[model samples]
Target chain A: MTIHTKTLKQLSQGLQTGEYSSQELTQAYLNRIQQHSTLNSFITVTETQAIAAAKQADALLAAGNAPLLTGIPMAHKDIFCTQGIKTSCGSKMLDNFIAPYNATVVDKFNTAGMISLGKLNMDEFAMGSSNETSFYGSALNPWADSTVPGGSSGGSAAAVAARLIPAATGTDTGGSIRQPAAFCGITGLKPTYGRVSRYGMIAYASSLDQGGPMAQTAEDAALMLQAMAGFDAKDSTSAQQDVPDYSANLNDSLKGLKIGLPKEFFDEGLNSEMATTIETAINEYKKMGAEIVEVSMPHLKLAIPAYYVIAPAECSANLQRMDGVRFGHRCTDPEDLNDLYIRSRGEGFGTEVKRRILVGTYALSAGYYDAYYIKAQKIRRLISEDFAKALETVDVIMGPVTPTPAFGIGEKTADPIEMYLADIYTIAINLAGLPAMSVPAGFIDNKPVGLQIIGNYFAEAKLLNVAHQYQQVTNWHQQTPKGFE
Target chain B: MSLTTDDVNKIAYLARLGINTEDTESYTADLSNMLNLVAQMSSVDTDNVAPMAHPLDTIQRLRPDQVTESNQRDNFQAIAPQVEEGLYLVPKVLD
Candidate 1:
């Protein structure tokens, strides 16, 4: 009766049939969180509050009325503001900050009757590719204790991998969710821009930030997303569209499905181990009656450059709220009005955050605006056009989620370029505003690797079908991390 | 100096960041290195390019302007560094 081994589908059915009360399920997760606390996957565990919510969920079930995610224990990335819970965004600035209102995603989860297992740790302000940027400290991969989980969604991915939570929420600005999901060997998806509301989710880059689901399997990821996606007036950018049944057509056959493998993803920098794993997954799809086409996304090389400029530029503007006079951390010394601003942020944000802020500010500066920020935007359009053209000829794109499997803690923290390179394959989807996913493919060095599946904008159902169909044929997603009984 | 030490100080202040003037020299050095890294964008020609503000080509979704937020100012400002009558207080600037 280990909580980590069971799927959300099974958990939900059990709850619906009165097999286990929400309180029992919440207690089991609380017990597991205590047991695996050494992983540091969670920054805050909502035991008392979660238990209360679970009691309410159970009551609803008993009353013969329950939501789609009724009584299921789930995890949230710390970036989302939870009413009355600590929402640190992995920075010292908000270390003492408790959100007064639930973020849109959190409110949606509550409405769906999902129990909050805990808040997963992440990079400060969702800035870095590695979780090392977190002010609380790094969240290591569950698969290999020494390796780093790709982040700022690292803690969420690690939580699901370690069996602490069945599924968790993750935000992707660049590759925050998918990269971490790949590194930790789980299922993570970043829906098309505007698909998910961002009002409650802390913004890193307004244009790029998207909140989605991360879980052990694609089906679980859909279940998690079902609770999180929708339109809200609070977030003007949220799409005004009906939420689709992501689990619909999930079990559909993959026969004759057109899969495009962008040539750029298989280039020189790809690790041989990851390359082998991805190729094997592609072949598995072929065996399952799918066609693999070699498509070219020539502007692929420009993604990292465009992302660096665009993400940071947007970040520099979005982060202006953390002034000393306002929210979060404020410096103690008050020599003058200026010192309050400098030392407060200097003391508040992490190194990666400061670096990006500095980089972003410079990019948006008057003289450099046209050269750096403006040009990056143009390149972004071309990248999007490339995807649009490719989609016309294909149903989906397959590639390595990351260039390598998750590396060990402190492995690439010092070398920012190396860490940035890890996001090579996944960043393009975000730049294109397309829905993409990372599904556990195979092992590399006994560590998990993910095969990235990308679909056209608003094509999440197709992407989920691709992952679900592969799961029916392969057992990779079923491979649980060690120390799980 | 692509930007002088004083220029760095001015920009930091303008951005609402407190830059320790004593560290201005070092800040200039760090910014110089970063700018050098970002300088790669200058070489690419972008004369005809339309700057992208969003990844999507869809028209900006607009909602009727009205009161959508509830009276959660107390809930929100409760986390502010200094809150008085629903306003975030700061050091006196009119002196």
Candidate 2:
């Protein structure tokens, strides 16, 4: 039997009926990954572990007892720690380090019998909008080789979009997951701040980092989210809420659902093609009996400014653990204690990582603390309050995921401003700790553009419902890049 | 409100990052450009506004003060460039 856009449901039915076993499915993905290494979508493939897990999944199936995610293959962002796997957050600093334990999220997948494909590549320490900063190099836009797959979850989105694996995990620290999903034409979700566990996730920003699923469809994300989300005593931040059947109302029509379109997201500097695409998506929602209303987020423009401060400040503190003396890449020659510290860090980190560390250290400095770092945090509350107020008026918010479709690989690398601008449309959600998703809306210049749908806290079900309802009518998510096929 | 080359070097040093004094010129230029945008926050009157570092202000209910981390001292020090007994090795600080 051929694998043609198989969902978890289809794959499970096949595995249960003995049409194919977990090992066969794992091998198929391994073969695809080998064939598509040119895409640079994966940093390290956990072939040994994946095969071992597949064998276990097969045994469970034979025993007639299997979990919801049994034998379902998934990929993880490199930022997540996998026991004995090289869990580099796409930076050279930790390039040689192998985690001694699995992250809470990784253990969940393993316990559910989900076969691991490998660790997907990401931006250096989950920074940057394009995947270019990765030490392993950038993931190419499968849709258009000339462009980049948006990042820092670029590899996670690309692998799923390329069908190397049906779905993958991505951590969104200020839109890392959603932006890449938008560029790669897949469904990616950034659940609320505490919706998923972050323990053992090599965190760049403790407060903003959130892990969620990137898959071919909203229902697929829902199924993965079912396994991914819940309270974990291991993670202090993990919510104490029970995991809902995300697929329960996935078929629920969007009738009478109120969606707010923040005027700020559509104002000046918005791309015309992107605007048309989002307008088309919003129009489709209207036809589905959803109400669209204009909303104002006064703090919208403040998000980028606030995020640059808070994310980097937190990143600066989190990365302090990697001093080279503590099991990471070390420099060749060092005179003394000071030399060791300097050379180890300077050589270990990438340009972007250093940049953030510098910025973060600056913000948190004593003299400048109140002037910059503390001020940004005050603005953060306002940003979340803006989302809270908007939610009072609408069930969900819809807008463009990014200002444009996937850009050329090296197009904005030289200009940091251009790179940061791509995330302008998505960063505020992280500040608000709101759940958001990027669904393929349509194409602009033959590259996919995603319609961003954001929901209030704990609104994962509604976002998935809306995305699922939209996917039933539109085939944008179904289209694949030609040459990859 | 903008930072100078001296400011960049000072911040880098304070952050415990060793920087080549010569490279500070270029680092200064790039940092100045980036920091200039960030300087906007200075204009906002946050004098009385309480700093909100996290989305939710709940004091983290950390799992009891017990040591949750495993005793991976041996495993952790396995790949250390320099290790002695249970401690990570570093050069002598004082002469």
Candidate 3:
């Protein structure tokens, strides 16, 4: 087997044993990245810096007492600010803006001795579900060239799935990380909100945005989260709770574990074949001594509407910083300050972003604030309460990440509302600020589907344990695309 | 509720985002469709439920009243579109 196909843990062992040098591994991955450029997974390759960093990691390894992740290569989603590197967040607004500092997540990974391959492509301002909104075009799915790789973290998932890099970082706000990870057939964990510091990570929705790890297995995800999860004083909303050792309980038994299957997720909207695949995966859990219980979350259907209002409202406020004054894209020869702000933003933002901003503006306008914004907040409480009540009876919840597998590139882009419904099953977890994961279950017509595992607040360790146990008995997560493999 | 072109224009102005005359009709239709989707929230009765601005419902953390950031105006202003003498230059705001 090629070194690229090995899991992160195995690669770590290889590096520790001197079977392969960090420089060699980094070069191999870089070559793979260049070979697979058709996937359009990366916005910048950072070749020279990556090589230099790998050499430094090699020196640390030679000197002894190096971290387990010392020589492993990975990449970051462009949303995370890396000093001296372009942090576009897949928008024309920030296309020319170079971040002056590193996001806390990037610094943590660098401190762990991991070599960063480069920045991956993503949706414009992390807004779209298909990644077509990116200023840099769509990132095609590795499974089928014609299909999308899911979004805002589309490039992260595609790169990891193709083995261009063993893993990469991703952020989830209304299923950006998990949904793409699902469509690409990988394991992605969205840590409980505030579990990871959001200090320099670009904001889409303040209350719901959380960064986590995407990898080929839950074990690798646990390893990545070990380095990524923690509180930072820089991020006011960061959790003060101590981050537990994520890798410690990865092997814990799932025997007698209560897994709740929300009945609302199985409605007619779900494709029947995909539902069968999910059921089969659940039956495997039943075999492992996990007791399945059907739970009702009646308010779950309202998550899409609630999220549309709340996320856009928060986005409208957060994105006001993009005025041409400080940095980012600016229009030439503006008539006045108002023209600069309007023309610059109008030129910088894409259609989806404009649509969202307009909706948010209307919703927060006078006479409509109480009707839309406040009403969504109240519905948000109900959604959170539903999850809280469900967790009272079950240890975790399981459902399909997307209605079906990856769809064609232009399939749902025509109707924005139709595209929004793609996240119906995954958005509520974010609303509740709970930890969840998308583990590859199986395939439908050569396309991949993910089985989502949801856990209560700060229950990431439990979620990882559940997903790891299933991955042990199934090879779905290990399956790679035909050409990529 | 369907939004008229005037509503779209008003919203664009409120957002400080320019919408081309040609794209106005499409933006109006798209924004109206999104609002129709958002209108579904009215079906849920949330009279007694409290509004949840934050998921964890934790109060904002307060820090000591001290300057934690050092002066890095040069590094920050290096990426500005137009700057002069440590100041960001913009179009004339005064007549």
The two-chain DockQ for each candidate, comma-separated, is 0.52, 0.67, 0.91
Output DockQ, candidate 1.
0.52
Q: How well is candidate 3 docked (DockQ)?
A: 0.91
Sorted by lDDT (best first), the order is 3, 2, 1
TM-score of 2: 0.97
Kindly list the per-residue Cα lDDT of model 3 for residues A158-251, writing each as its tens digit.
Answer: 9999999999999999999999999999999999999999999999989999999999999999999999999899999999999999989989
Model 1 C-alpha lDDT per residue in residues A1-485, reported as the tens digit of each score = 65558899989888999888889988888898899898889999988889988989989999987976899998899999998899999999899888888898998888888989779999989988888899999897888878888799999998888888889999999989999988888899999899988988999998888999998788988888877888877786778778889898899989999999999999998988778889999999999899989899988887887888888888889888888776789988667666677788877876677667877887888797877888888888878888998999999999998888878788887667667767878887888888999999999878888899999888888999899988988888888887865
- Maximum-DockQ candidate: 3
Interface RMSD, every prediction, one decimal place = 2.3, 1.5, 0.7
Clashes by residue pair, model 2: none
| Regions more than 4 Å wrong, model 3 | none
Model 1 CA lDDT for position A283: 94
TM-score of each: 0.95, 0.97, 0.99
Where does the lowest 10-residue lDDT sum fall in candidate 1 chain A?
Answer: A413-422
Question: After aligning candidate 1 to the native by TM-score, how far in Å is the CA of A6 from where it should be?
Answer: 0.3
Better of 2 and 3 by lDDT: 3
Q: Once superposed on the true structure, which residue ranges of model 2 sit more than 4 Å away at CA?
A: B20-23, B42-48, B65-70
